[model samples]
Target: MQDKTNNQESSLTRRDFIKTAAIGAGAAAIVSMSLTEGQSQTQPAEAPKTQPSATPLKLEDVLKKAREKLYPRCRVCPECDGRACSGEVPGMGGIGSGKSFHNNYDSLAKIQLKMKTFHDVKKPDTSITLWGHKLAVPILSAATGGVTYNMGLKGKMTDEEYIDALLGGCIKAGTIGMAADGIGDPLDIYEIRLKAVAKYNGKAIATIKPKTQEEIIKRIRMIEKAGGLAFAVDIDSAGRAARALPGQTVEPKTMKQLKELAQCTKLPFIIKGIMTVEEAEMAVECGAAGIVVSNHGGRVLDHTPGSADVLAPIADKVKGKIVIFVDGGIRYGADVLKMLALGADAVLVGRPLLRGAVGGGQDGVALLINKMKNELVDSMVLTGTADVKKVKRDILIV
Candidate 1:
């Protein structure tokens, strides 16, 4: 019986050993398959590389490129010939004597002063309600003539395109646009600008340099019919001319003439080219809803003090009666801030738009306006003003 039991145990041990060996072989086969699959599925890691096409160009870079490509350096140095040293020469080549040309530096200085003086201590309210329309900022595109003549791609765009660019770009950027009349027959330019303003749903102040009060009324009526929200008489340009251009021949409308024209239109009346407090007061008394305290952008009288310089006094005198606006050498948001601080309800941009138009048409104008708006916003943020109306005199150091 012992021999039989030993034989059975030996058989069981042999069977168990065979079963273990078979399972080990199967497991080895499975491990080999998994290793092969893993090797097949694995990918080698690579170092990251930058693609040239994926990099973004900054706005300054884009503008620099565009400016280089489109605009040539201005050859005419009007500033150098007209700048007068204070206390050095009487009637010398300087602003304020009518013998010199417009100087942006002078304009900027005054603008800075007004901005610092008025805006320094006072809370600036940049938001303006004019003619029942709310504007984000008071900086409007003042009515400018000869933009097409001065700057265009060889007249690539029509008058309508010019107006469209100004209205759609500048007006939409938070400023109203004024269209200058008397560049040609009043009706044609007026109609073109009116249509452009309607297209953009923007506000426009149409200006007429009429030969007579009757003509002023007729032009004002036409402007209103064409959807102009305000009317301005370019009183400064009535009998003035720049260097060689044919002088404009509008009769000097009396205060009564201005009032009669204002009465003819239901829209707000804006008198452009006011440089004195007395003139500002007269404008208000004449029922002017607004007064543009400008020196015809220093075009009419070359040697006049920069528009910025006179803004504070005029603004102080006419604060409650009318919306005080200014134009001249406004190149940046800082310039706008300076004007606002000085007591201007708003400011106007002139040559910069022409520069943009000359450089890139509508896109160029839009770029210029966008840059200005961004600059304004940056200034506001840096000064800790959240709202446009909050920009005050204290924000400026000088």
Candidate 2:
């Protein structure tokens, strides 16, 4: 009786149901008019069927739609200048004044590739062997994360899901993937990510934040256990004084401390966040297997020169001494080629790969990588460069 009473209180009448259906589905009622008025009522002509386009939507087009629907913090803009997202340090923006972020883009833009012709070159080989792993291209996805803080939860992807797409996608595309360590993230997160990475035959690399020596060493041990090919530490993260987790500390390392850490690890130890020539020299001196010319993606400090502007000097000084990799403002394959000409053995792509992984998963990442590779090849052919390994300095319009 009580259930009957509740049903009766909210019951819908037949008229109400019809009205609701009409309102909900936009049902058009064809009421029969008075038959006497127009006995010979003519039927309406049939509408023509629209044909679907023969060409399918490209992966980039699909990614554009996914960007709108899934990604929250990042809009995946056509151009990723710092203007749309400024002073967004804890997230994706730069620190303090946002000048550092702007500098990365501006400095890279200042470099112009001198076009050339009249050389017998077909397709340039764009492969490089790093840390005993041969990559299809001289490009790899930079270590990027913080889906909750950096990209946002609305991306409809978990940290694990994102990393799976990122690392897995890169590996599938014939390259390496770099996994990131978040300050706020728990330790187990790294374990889960590395477990996923193991399927790629340890081609995926990992980067640790500048945690304390004990913490850094502990994490390095974990990476070693995970069958990782190499590991890196972003020392520039020390500038992020405002965002460190409680009980976590990031400090500058002395030469002795760096050598100690270097000696402890058997893996190819890479030191990221080298901005100036001095730091680049110091990194090699400390027994680094490789050094990344980066400004922490301009997230650590404000008003620093972009990695591109300083890359040539660093490369000239330590080109053969230590393997040189660079990141920042690398939007396309042309940019990748530019970095190679300026003096980078390889380049790390950050946000674009994130968007690719979020939008189309493995396929999306592979497509983006292919796009960059295609563009790099096109740039190489036009410049009459036969081999990617021997990209001449003269090709650059310094």
Name the top TM-score candidate: 2
Model 1 worst lDDT window (10 residues): 31-40
Which residues of candidate 2, in runs, are more than 4 Å off?
1-57, 69-72, 241-243
User: How does residue 20 of candidate 1 score in lDDT?
Assistant: 40
lDDT of 1 by residue, 29-116 (tens): 2211001111211111110122323222233333333233222221112222233222211112223543323454456644332222
Estimate, for each residue in 228-259, the C-alpha lDDT of model 2 and write its tens digit: 99999988887654666687677778898889
Q: RMSD for each model, in Å, please?
A: 26.6, 16.0
State each candidate's clash count: 13, 0
Per-model CA lDDT versus the true structure: 0.59, 0.76
Candidate 2 has what TM-score? 0.83
After best superposition, candidate 1 residue 109: deviation in angstroms?
4.0
